[model samples]
Target chain A: MRFEVKNASFSYKNDRKIFEDVNFSVDSGDIVAILGPNGAGKTTLLKCILGILKLESGEALLDGKDVRRMQERELFKRVSYVPQAKNTTAAYTVRDTVLIGLAAELSVFKSPGEAEEERVRKVLKELNIEHLIDKKCNKISGGELQMVLIARALISEPEVLILDEPESNLDFRNQLIVLDTLTKLSKRGIACIFNTHYPSHALQRANKAIILSEGHTVCGDCESTITAEAIEKAFNVKATINEYSDGGNTIKTVVPISVIR
Target chain B: MVEKKSIKILRTVLLIILPIATAIIALMIGRIAISPKDVFLILTGQGDMVETVSRMTVISFRLPRIILALFVGAGLSVAGCAFQGLFANPLATPDTLGVASGASFGAAVAILLGFNAIPVQISSFIFGILAVVLTVLCGRGKGKGMTMIILSGIMIGSLFSALISFVKYVADAESQLPAITYWLMGSLASTDYKSLIVGVPPILIGILILFILRWRMNLLPLTEDEIKSSGTNVLALRAATVLAATAITAASVSMCGQVGWIGLLVPHMVRMRLGSNFKTVVPASISIGAVFLIIVDTVARSLTASEIPISILTAIIGAPFFIYLMRRGGSFR
Candidate 1:
């Protein structure tokens, strides 16, 4: 499936325009990283794609179908979303949390059957969090919780997975874990769109990068398109793009040697 | 593992047995002090005491009131549990949604207008439903959260309460004022088989509906986006469940004035023991609430020559316990 956001724009009631004429597309097995500084409407753009927030103009199309016109359940079946982080208000075990993802497949009046349980167990095993099945989600480590949440998203077997800063709250190890998981999911033919602050992670896993500045996509291409000039222009920071010995590049914010004095 | 399983089984067994024992105690040790043997005899139908005072006391007055207490208690508690789940707030109850106040306003209006007979009950039911509808409509959100719902409920409840007060002020002092005041404090004193018959069906049906949807109630606290992404229609499910819960609450309140505490405290108590899963919590609330109210009503009738309002006794008992629970973080999920 292909998701195409066509010239979409949105502004809040406070007259803060979050997105303007932002157009992007993702095909199956593509890892698209939306890169932006704080307040660059990275979250807003994701919401627009998920149809949680309405576009001021234009539309988001999923395989030639307008997302706005599609029923929520239909859209949900095709697109899975993992929020940045959520506070567990009630005590739900890891298994229970993941089982909620099977809600769409079950009848409204009926509980999840053996097949659903089997699916949930399979997803848990796939995520390698099978040991955390009976553990409380709130009491678990951040990486485990992230994996559990990803497991929840995968339970629906969605074609497209939209993750909002999956690495935001994690430490370096967990960040790598999450990024590796996203890369693995992409390899499984799932189109993964995520937002990240760290550009190197995107450069490592994303086949494409979208840079948003002031609610507009200033740059949308592979890593080569996200140059030092674009970074300086978008974030108003002077940075040097250095080519690593491993054929990878790093955009490091530069300060003059005289500033150290 | 075996010990843990045994403990769980023991807890479950205790949860069932304790309530039954309390109900028996409530029935046996009432104002008349019926013996356990007599109680058994009266229950079984093989009894020489049928011709004597035992039959009249046990069959007519005590039995119905006890039964009323059980049903009213269970009904209100179940309704409270549902409301709490619906609002996703531990503090929510029928009164929070203005159903009880609306019922009070309705009954007060009926009394003031001298609408005697079944029409008064109908009027109460109408007002109760109307209050809940108004609250939900006023509080319904485009993007606002539970705060709007709670604020609307409070605003509507206060409005209805003010209206009730206004009606009281204008009411004929000799007849209506005392009646309104008495009703406001709440009582199961006037309960009969008729009101019980009218009341139990809706409560049972409402509880059944809630029970059927109990597992889904887990979805209530989740944000709209989360719920939608999980493949549930948040709006449709919320509307249906809220309406059903409010209807049950209104019906229960309209039947019996404003039997406070049972709705508020029983659900909390249930959650404090059982987990917050509505599947267990709802049924636990019903059973515990039934037992609690039956005992409270028994004390209300037996403690004095004349009956005290069940609400007063419940408030006296429940208020302190509620505060204690709140202080101990018992209500937090």
Candidate 2:
């Protein structure tokens, strides 16, 4: 499956246009990142593609059909979303929260049964958070909660997974857990699209990137699109990209030095 | 959160049995005290051991009130539960949509117009729905829909309350004023088979709808954008919640003035025990609400020779108990 955003544009009331005619596409087995500075409409761009905010122009398409035109069941069957951890602490047990992913499959009058429960447990196990199934969402750590949210997005068996700041509030180890899971899922032919503040993360995990800079937007292969100039321009900072190697593996890191005037 | 099958069955049995057992006890000990044997005889159509006056007291006077107690209690509590979830605030109650005040305003107008049981109920029902409709229309704007809804509901509630006062001001003090005031106090005293026939269906239908859609109700506490990602129609879920809750409240208030506390109290008590799963909460609110109201109603009629309004007693009995529970129980959130 291919998830594409074409000519997307949005602006808040009385403000200048946030981003205009932004375009990107993520195919199966691909990991994509939407990286930008604060107020650069990175979240806004994800919201537009996910159909949370209506695009002032252009449309989001899944296999050539306008996503907003698709019914929730038909559309979400192909695409699922994992929102930021801060916005999703509903006080349900972890098992019940993951069962919510099947909302479109069940009728209004139907409760999730044994079959659904099995799927929820399977998904939780895949994320290695199966022990947290009976724990309430509010009681869990932020990192565990993010994993639960990911479990929910995956329970639908969607081909396209979109996440907003999936690891923003986590510690280093948990960040690795989330990004590693994304890489693992992408290997299973799932298309992963995420928005982030870290350009190094994009270069490290994403094969393709969309970097929203001050006036120019760069969207293509991560190595070329996330250049040192792109980082300085997007974030208003002086930065450099450095690469290290351990045996056969090469790791790329971007280090920021000073704020630009 | 997941109980064993046997334990779940046991809980369900207790919920169903508690209300029935309490209702039977309530029937036996009303104004005319009757024995358990006689009450059983009357219920089973073996009334040879029962006197005519006792039979009338059991069959004619007490039965309808008990039934009304069951429906009104269940209706109001379910409405309260729905509102709490829809607003995602624990403090939200059945009156959040102004249905109680709206119905009261309609009843006040009808009383001033010399209307009795059926007409007043009809008027109250219509105005209750109308008030929510007007609130929805006024609340449409460019911000969070729930905040706008709550603000508009408050304004509409206040508006209906003012209208009710205006009706009182214009009413004939000798007859209409007292009747209106007594009605506003809220009692099961005037309930009979006739009004029951006219009033119970709307409340019953509303409860049925909420009961069927109970699983989907968990989504009510989720933010609008959050709910959208689930691919469920949040708008329809919200509309169903508001309309069903309004129907329950309006019908209940129209049937017996504006009985307070039960709507706000019962669901909280259930959530305190069952957590926030609507699958359990909705059904528990129905059964526990019925039991709670029937007990209150029984106390209201038997404790004093002259019937005391239920609204007065619910707070008198409920507030202290609620506070105690809140203190003893862990965080309600």
Candidate 3:
């Protein structure tokens, strides 16, 4: 499915405008990263484009259909959102937490049965976190918990996966684990959109990037959207995009110099 | 880890039997100590050997009260379970939204006006619903969280409590005040068939509705965006929960004023022992809560010649267990 945001804008009451006329579109098997500095409304833009928070004067179209018009049950079945794993509030077990992602399959009177549990098992196995199924979600390591949350999103069987800071607040290894999973999922024809603080993450894995920073908006084609100029403009820091070769794969890393206006 | 399927089935079977066993035991151990055989014989209408007074004690007095206790316990516990999950707060109870205090104020007003049992119950039910509505009105706002609802509940609860005191201030000291005061403390001594007929339906209907909605309610503890994105209408689900919880609580309070702690105590017990699945927690709460109250009521009447208030016994029993569970730190799940 192709998800498109057209002329979208938002602002809080009595607060300055966050963004205006921001337009972007992403399609299946695409890894799109949304990057911005603090208070640039990266998360807020993600929510608005998804119709979670209403756009000020634009529409988010899923396959040319207005998202607001689509029933939530149908919409969520095709699109899934994942919060940061550690943000989980309840002490639900890993299995149950994943089971909740199949909310579209459940009704007021109908709960998940054997078939659903079997699906949960399959999804967890696919994510290689089946071992953590019975463990309390609170007990799992942050990286494992992120995998569990991914399993939850996959269990919903959505075509589009949007995540808020999917790899933030993680150790280097765990960050790699999450980023690699995103690449894997996107390769499987799932459109993965995620918010990130790191510009290199967007440059490294994203085929498409939307940069929301300092009243400047750039979209489409990671090559153009993630330039050193865009980085300096977005994050207000002088930075260099360094290139290194690791095992025949060219890696790009953003190195920050000093704060700049 | 989750329990084995067979063991879970066994626990369910045992839970279903628990209340029946307690109720039967309660029936036999009152002031007039009737034998098991005689109690059974009386129930089966074959008790020629049992005295009329004993039969009356079992059939007319204890039976109605036991049944009342069963409904009251089940209602309060299920409400508590639902409320706790709904708010994602362990301390949230059926009365968390001030339904109990609302009902109590209604009953106090009824007593002050010299109303009978049925009218008192009706008044209580209406006011109970009133309190929940007021709480929602006071608490609801865009992007507000459960804490707002809880704060509103406390505010409304205190408002009703103060109203009850006002009713007492002007109540007939010799008659109405004692009646209102005793009713507020909670008791099952005044239960009869007529009142039960009016009261039990609300509790029963509420339980049945909640049981029907059991699957959807598992989403109760999730964060707002998680729930909103789940494709289900969370507002409808939450509204249904609040309505059902209010109905059962109002009905229970109407039948017997403010039987405290069953909601918190029984649900936590069920959750601690059975895990946090509402699939198990809802039914377990219904079964165990009934049994818990039957035993408590029996002890209340039998332990002392003058009947002790049911609330006192419940608090005496519930507070320590709650503290123990709190200290252990694994029960909330």
Local accuracy of candidate 2 as per-residue lDDT tens digits, B174-244 = 98888888878989988899889888998999999999989889888876766887888888999888888
Model 1: CA > 4 A from native: A13-16, A86-88, A113-118, A215-220, A243-261, B1-25, B35-49, B96-98, B116-159, B325-333
lDDT of 3 by residue, B85-125 (tens): 88777767866678889988887788788887678777887
Candidate 2 segments exceeding 4 Å error:
B1-3, B116-119, B129-159, B318-333
User: What is candidate 1's CA lDDT for residue B191?
Assistant: 67
Tens-place lDDT digits, model 1, residues A134-233? 8877678878888888898899999999998899878988898898899899999999999988776776788888888873466467667577666676
Cα TM-score per model: 0.86, 0.94, 0.94
The candidate, 1 or 2, that scores higher on DockQ is 2
Error of 3 at B130 (Å): 4.4
How well does model 2 score by local distance difference test?
Answer: 0.86
- TM-score, structure 3 vs. true: 0.94
